[model samples]
Target: RVFEAMLLVGISFSPLAGDLVTLVAPQVAKAASLVFLLGAGALFLWEINAAGRWVWPTTIGLGLDIVVGTMALLATAGMDGGIASLLLINLAAGGVLLSLPKAFFFAGIAVGLQYLEHLLSLAWFGTAERSLSEVSLFAVGYLAVTGLSQLLRQEVSQRQQLVEQRESDVESLSQLNDLIIRRMKSGVLVIDAQGRIQRINEAAWSLLGNPSPTRKDLTEISPELWRRMQQWRSSGRGDYTPTALVERGTEVVPRFVAVPQSPHHSAIVFLEDSSLLTRQAEQLTLSSLGRLSASIAHEVRNPLAAISHAAQLLAESDSVAAADLRLLEIIRGQCLRMNAIVENILQLSRREQSKPELVNLRRWVVEFVDEFRTVQPLGGDELRALAPETAINVVFDADQLQQVVWNLAKNALRYGRLPEAPARISVVARRLPETGQAVLEVLDRGPGIAEKLRPHVFDPFFTTNEFGTGLGLYIARQLCEANQATLELVSVAGGGACFRIAFNAQPETLRGDKLPEP
Candidate 1:
């Protein structure tokens, strides 16, 4: 458009261009040039918005230029020099707009018109001093332009293709990089100089506790992570100190790397889950412990059985005095406790791999509560169960799930009571709406686990009660993990302990037995 406009502007100012531009001069018909200019302007208008639709407009422009050039030549009394050069410019423009075959065809028409004008000029003016060679030179120039433009067009086309291919390759690589980053196990966050999260991967968002998607600031999601990032920036060292949203959550260890100077981002931060590494180490330790317990099982059990059996026999003899009866009772109680400890260790060693199956938790929990109430003494205590009417399917070992719930309920009944108050236990089963996971929560009206001890509550051999075996919670957690479930000590707002078992989401291709219909 600009090229055509500039050509029209130059034509308009041709009179100022003097005799060298003979299209308009002192003796020339200004009206004729005006007509030619109008025709050119009209052709330009016709070409508007047809650049992508290449064929028709270029043909129209070429034909118009040929007819108009011939008129200008004849009207200016064989002004071949000026009209010929102008004709060359028109040919070059045509060559650019049209394909080679059509362009050459138009150039031939202009050549033919040039000869026709020269013949008429000779007859009218009765012999002029112009030779055939001069007219032929203009003809040569037209063909040269058509050829040169075809070459220039081809070169420009190859370069354009190269550029487009390079752009496509760059886009593919960018998408691949994004996919890799999103799938990475370690969390990745790109931060700008203004402390904005310019880019964050799925693992990073999840590690930061899945903050609101619209929150772009780093500090808004996890302040501890932001602080650690600042500390690492100042010292320029590996800061592997773990950060967690809660005491029971997996700890994330973040590492920072300085990115090259960029307007959008200043650094790339990587978050590694230290909890996975810790769990691997813990698994090794437990495996060894399980082996050792199995090795000492026979030796330990024989002695424990003999002591417990002797205590019962001696008590039944009646030769035992009343004062010694208390001592006997203590001895028997200690023996029983020892035997219970031995039994727990054996259970840990002999623990089977989970055979996860689909179970309807709603019906299961109702039946579980009924059995629990029948077996356990519930003196002055309240035991209530709430389950959703709809079936809540979960992937778990039915036996293990029952055992875990039972232990949690027993603990709730035993210690979930305030002084001079009855214990209140509630077993609720429901499906989580957002994640489609089944949840079985056992809540009590007892003092919740202290914040300081919350982290270690699931650790083996860690307990506050003198008579309590710490293995209960630990074993329960192991069983849950074996079934691809999670057990956490949830903080209750009503001043009580609430243990939650978040079961694995229901399978899409569930094929096992469901709770035998209704």
Candidate 2:
């Protein structure tokens, strides 16, 4: 579009370079000005429609160029260098965007118009000296520009194709390597549409009784797995059945799922030993967890309450010695800790509906810290809560937020302290500048978690400390997800762990989500 505008501007201004009546015939100049106006309107239309849709506009534009070129030649008696240069620029620019055949065709039309203009000037105008040599030279110049533009276009196209091919090759190699590494524990077999194996992980090879190199096809190694794969392709159902692929070999369960977005009818077959798991069957039991809490209360909490009641009754006796009171206090403290552990276990088992409310985070954090200080016995541990003065609001369940924050603060006081040093922990509330989401962080000045242990921190029943039940961080994360928020262990600059809770708020709340009941 810019090139076209330049051509139009040059054409419109060329007559003004000298006295209009002396340099160009008045009648011819008026006709050319009308043509130039139409050309300007076409440029705007092409721009509004997007210049890439190039058929009608280019035709109208080039046709106007021919008209103006002819008018200039005849009006100036074939001595208008300025108007001829504008025509040459339009042709050269068109050649880059147009096909080779179209470029040559337009160039031919332009050259022919120039020659015809010279003849008209001599026969009708009879104004001044003119020659055919100048027209011949312009004709040669137009053809040369068309050929050069085509060469440059081809060179750019080849370079782009080469770069794209290299990227595809690199991506393919990376995917193949990642596939092998991630599937090493569980067997993976990728079979192409041609019924030949494309890849087989080490675990897959071992499950097939270490087949020879000649066993390339799926049918050659395990006919049962091959049969099941074909059944999945026909039925689109991946179910499990245990079968010994080789007689007197390991009993393996074969499941097949389609490789997504594969060009061919490729499938990935996962071979798991039957002894490993019945993972799908256990999912049903997890949803009926209200029964679990009832049973724990009956079997464990009943005895725990009796013990706690007995300790309180024993401490009330007037004859109990001062030294014996310390012993009784230890017993009472152990009972409380045990009850807290049982409560955590019960909390992890139940699910209840979440009621989200808009929370003023800055006010909530300060009030929550004050309440925590009254209940939890923090011995020589410095706990501070801070937030910005501006209120940061988020939609979350108030009780569930309390539970999640309590667990994080408890873990910080328990394990976040350095050896032979008092624990210093902070609960911070702020609104993130980039996302405008409310964030709450529990930070501690302690040895940070090891890199290798980071991935399994949220896994059920995973813990480094022998005394821990390992349900604190896991339950906290679950509660956050119920509120449409993320709980992650964000790395801090100084040597400490920062567990960040980043909330995702809506105009109201996230509905239809249920967290575990207490």
Candidate 3:
């Protein structure tokens, strides 16, 4: 429109175009000015009415451009006029607003109109020879402009789509990363160079004692941790020892790692529970012990067997004196103790995979007690089975359960006897109504374990008795765990020790059989 207005003003002034307007036919020149004015007025009206829509405006605007260009060319009488190139602008606009086929359509129309104006000039005024070559050259130029414009527009569209897709991918990846970090078991804390907390996960927040710590400095939370972190950072070593943060009786192991490629000087601090570290260390020790036990049984069993045979031979010899016989007995007892230790270690090393089966506790306990009384006659009536009137079913390895019960029963018979009541060990089997779990308890009348020794009772090689191998209870507990049971010592009412074996009860393990009424 601005170009059209400038052309109209130039033709009106007659001086800007080197007085070419005056040299041309006055009526043709006036007609060209009217066309320019009308085209500019239509464009202004189109823009005002089609404020938001562009398809119709673009189509009409391009049409007006072609008409004005053709009229200007005719006014100057064909090739003599320099207005032929003005058709290129209309074709370029069509290429930008429409598809390739539509832009080509406009290009075809402009070329045909140019040729028509040339033919009209030749017929109306006795002009020179018609130049079909000039018309062909102009057609090629118009098509070239339209093709280049469309190519540039397509390239811009493709770049914009690529940018949007990359942005969406980046956003999705960021959200996934944040979700993983938040749910991770290990505590993660991001700290800046200024020693302030930038971000902390739930685990880290709980490890910090759940303080309302928004952008709080590390020193304010724990001076010891801050001091250790600063020392680690200054040391410039990748492998620094973890430091302990002991606050309010809870200990956490803190490790610092520098975030690589971070513009701001920042570090990621990992806080792990002390108990979790201890469990990991314990697992490693158990693995090593399992290997060591295999070697010990092979190397020591043969020598131990020979020593026991020699002790038996010496005891049977009639030439041995009475005092010598006492020494022989002592040697024999020592040999037996050593054999028990070896057997226990071998059992730990070669533990069989647990095969669980549902057992009726009441009926099973009755049969077990009868068998135990035959083996251990000294307990006599002291060992009794106390079970619920109704049968309670529990899942466990029958052989493992037997070993565990025998160990607990033997311990109770040895240390659970009182001067007044010599036989008071009882095996009680019942279901805990509240938790729906099966419990087997060995209750004793003897003095209970001391508070200080209770924690170590289930530890291997932990025993108070001089003659004990100290592996019975530990092995028993380990076997119980393999069968998904827990063995813990609880205080019995009115003074005595009660070792409780709680079995995990599943719905499928429950038996429908009820005990017959007696």
Model 3 over residues 360-479: C-alpha lDDT tens digits?
A: 789888999999988888634478899988878788888889999999999998888777668588899988789878999999988888889998898777889878989899888888
Query: What are the per-residue Cα lDDT tens digits for candidate 1 across 260-328?
Result: 867665889998899877888998997898778767865788988888898889989878888988888
Weakest lDDT window of 10 consecutive positions for candidate 2: 509-518
Tally clashing residue pairs in candidate 1: 0
Mind giving the per-residue lDDT tens digits that candidate 2 earns over 1-518?
34544543454456563443243465666566666766767676775787468755666676677677667666653346556767887787677767788878888898888788777777776743456787688788888877887787678768879999999999999998877656676778888766688878888888888989677887877787778888888888855878888878778888887888998879888888775554334334533553565466558998999999998999999988989999999889888877866777776665577788777788888888888888998889889999987777778889999999998998888889899998899999997788777799999999989999897787655788756766678778878988899899989988888999998876354455432211
TM-scores of the candidates in the order shown = 0.57, 0.40, 0.54
lDDT of each: 0.78, 0.77, 0.78
User: Better model by TM-score, 1 or 3?
Assistant: 1
For model 3, the local distance difference test gives 0.78
Q: TM-score-based ranking, best first?
A: 1, 3, 2
Global lDDT of model 2: 0.77
Candidate 1 runs further than 4 Å off: 1-185, 190-199, 206-237, 242-251, 256-268, 274-287, 293-298, 316-320, 433-436, 509-518
Model 3 regions more than 4 Å off = 1-186, 213-217, 230-246, 260-264, 272-290, 313-330, 352-446, 473-518
